[model samples]
Target: MTSVRVAGVGLTPFGDHGDRAGRDLFAEAAAAAIDDAEIDRAAVDQLAYGNFMGALAEQQGHQAPLMAEAAGLDCPATRYEEACASAGVAVKAAVEAIRAGTADLVVAGGMERMNCLDTGEATEALAIAADELYEVRAGMTFPSAYALMAQAYFDRFGGGRADLAHIAVKNHANAVPNEYAQYQREITVDDALDAPPVAEPLHLYDACPITDGASAVVLASEEYVTANDLDAPVEITGVGQGGDRLALQDRDAIAETPAATEAAEVAYADSGITAADIDVAEVHDCFTIAEAMALESLGIADSGEGIVAARDGKTTPDGDCPVNLSGGLKAKGHPVGATGGSQIAELTRLLRGDHPNSEHVADATTGVAHNAGGTVASAVVHVLEVAE
Candidate 1:
């Protein structure tokens, strides 16, 4: 199989883009990536785009061709929608295409204009990612759904608000230096604990904000990279995906996401790297509780020990392993479809020693990106390393 590498990455600052269309945002990111790769627009062989709720958010569908045209690329284009894991899946497809010798150069990314909808409308649109009959019909929004998970985690692990508060504080601090982050201000644990409650055990600070953004990456086969002399490319060593029951209630353990664990396992196996070998990571932290669960799922911490790791500073930049140097979804913003691409972009930047955060892991060589969709029903994990 052919090896794949990320030659370039780009992203628009994640926030409320009042009137910006998803296509326009994606075009900007795509162009930036193309420029960063120093590749001609006509050289892109294919495009893999991810967008969730574009039809509902903007009453637009069939966005693949539209985005490709907007980016000035005349190429075959396809869209992947797996809720928040959309971009992760898109990246996986691009990698697979290159490995299979189907395409030598591909532009893969995601975009979402979630701010176009009102609060209630946005809530409804996001809820559609869950099991409509079992989860959404019961009037369970994401915050409430994850609130139950938070409560269950505390019940099983014996931690409370203060434990989760650490995640909010740490991620907020990390975001301060990230210009592309949605929330750049630092907050204290008290600020997180005192914030208005969105759900019991889950405060406003625990939840990621409603955001609109886009992120893109240029991927090329090793053969193409060598021929084109692309500089400082980051090799994609492993990619894995997993799925589970869609409804949160169907899982035997509400506090855990087996899909994430399974995906990480496959990625680690493919890369010949263990959890301890990962110098840094970017995981889905849609909620503070989600981050704790992700840490456990990714095997960075044992079951029910993720909160302990967070509180003990084990996951901080100066700790055993730095997680979410990009501020994660909590502070960097979660644009649903765009988030996975953003995560990969951040990891690529870190591996290239170009991350905006000065606190990024020193001499980091290996990194992992974990992206989940809709209550962890679907997940994708990728292991990346600096070119050897």
Candidate 2:
């Protein structure tokens, strides 16, 4: 199979875009990506887009063609939705298409608009990602679902809210230098501990904000890169996805995310690298505890030890393996469908030595991006190498 390179990437600042249309956000990101790639839009062979709640948010469906037109692209457009992992899977499809020789130049990304809706409306819309008959009916919102996971972790292991608070402080600090982050200011551990509780053990600072944003990536095959004389240096070497039961009740263990473990296992094997080889990472951190769980599942931290990875300075930017140099979904904002693409875009820039926080990992050669959907029911992992 031919290698796939991240030729270019674009992102709309992750925050509230008042009255902005989803397609409008996507168009800006896509155009920026195309411009960065220095490739004629005419060379694009396909478009893979992701949006989670267009129908509910804007009453607009059949968004693939609409986004393609908005982005000034004329090509076969496809939409992939796996909750918050939407854009990750979209990019994964782009990589597979190029690897299969079905297309060389493809645009993959996602957009999400949540600020347009009231908090209640947006929460209900997002709840559809869970099992409606089971989890949703029981009044289980994401904050609470994640709270259960936190409690499970504390029960099985031994940690408190103080441990999760460290993650919030670390991510917020990281976001200060990230132009695309939602919350770019630092917070103290005491501030996090004292913040209003969203759910027990998870305070306001511990959870990611509901955000509106978009991100896009231009990917090309190695053959296309050489043939077109592109200067792409970051290559997507591995992609893997795994799924678990949709309902939180059906899962065997709430504390452990088997899906992410499975996906990381496959991605690691595919990339011929282990977790120890990962110099940096950007994992889904919709909540502080989620990041801890992700670290464990991805093998960066052993079970029970993941909770304190941030507090121990292990996942800090100056630490052994910095995670979420883009601030992660925690302080970077969670625009649902768009976050996955944003993670990849941030990684591409960091690996390319263009990110504000790249100095932390200046000698890094390999990085990982992990995206997950609803309670870790869906997970997608990608491995990137500095091909330069």
Candidate 3:
């Protein structure tokens, strides 16, 4: 298989992009990525875009071709929508194209304009990712779903809500330096613990906010990189995806996600690296409990010890293995489809030694991104390494 490299990455600050069309947001990100790659727009052979709720959020469909045109590129265009894991799926497709000798250069990314709707409407839009017949009908919003998981985790793992608060505190602190993060202010564990409840055990501070943003990456074949004299390309060493039943009620275990475990196993095997070898990571943390579950699912900690890992600072920037130095979804904001691409873009910056966060891992050479969709029903994991 031909090696695939991330030649450049770009992102728009995640926040309320008032009245900005999703295509326009994506176009900005795409142009920045192409410029960063030092490649002409004509060099891109295909575009793979991700957007989870364009039809609902913007009353728009068939966005791929529109985004391509907005980016000033005339190429084959495709869209991948796996809810929150949308951009990860798009990146996976771009990699496949490069590795199959089908295209030398592919522009892949995701965009979401979720703030266009009010909070209640946005919640309704997001609920569509769940099993409509089962979960949605049961009035299971995302926070409520994860709140159940949080309670189950405490019942099984012997930790309470305070342990989850530690995750919020750490991620908020990490977000302080991220200019692109939606919330840059730091918070305390008490702030998370005392905030009004969204769902019984989960507080207002425990969830990621509705965000509108876009992110893009320029992926190229190794041959193209060498021929174009690309600078400091980051190699996509491994890619893995897994899926499970969408409804949480049907799952055998609510505290742990088998899909994430399977995806991580495949990614590690493909990359020839283990969790212990990962110097840094960006795991999905749409809810604080989700972060703890992701740590265990990715094999960074034991099943019941994820909260302990966070409380002990093992996952902090100065810890042995830094996770979510970009503030994570907790503070960095979650734009659904765009989050997976944002994770890739952040990891690329970390590996390139240019991330704005002071907590960035020193001498980091390997990084992994864990993106999950719709209550962990789907997951995509990618391992990236600095080009040697």
Clashing pairs in 2: none
Please report, in order, the local distance difference test score of every candidate based on alpha carbons. 0.91, 0.94, 0.91
Q: After superposition, how far is residue 379 of candidate 1 from its true place, in Å?
A: 0.5
lDDT of 2 by residue, 62-119 (tens): 9999999999999999998999999999999999999999999999999999999999
**Per-prediction TM-score, please?**
0.98, 0.99, 0.98
Q: Which number leads on lDDT? A: 2
| TM-score computed on alpha carbons, candidate 2 | 0.99
- lDDT of each residue in 341-381, candidate 3, tens digit only: 99999999888877886345768888999999999999999
lDDT assessment of candidate 3 = 0.91
Error of 2 at 275 (Å): 0.8
- Per-residue lDDT for 39-130 in model 1, tens only? 87899999999999999998999999999999999999999999999999999999999999999999999999988888899999999999
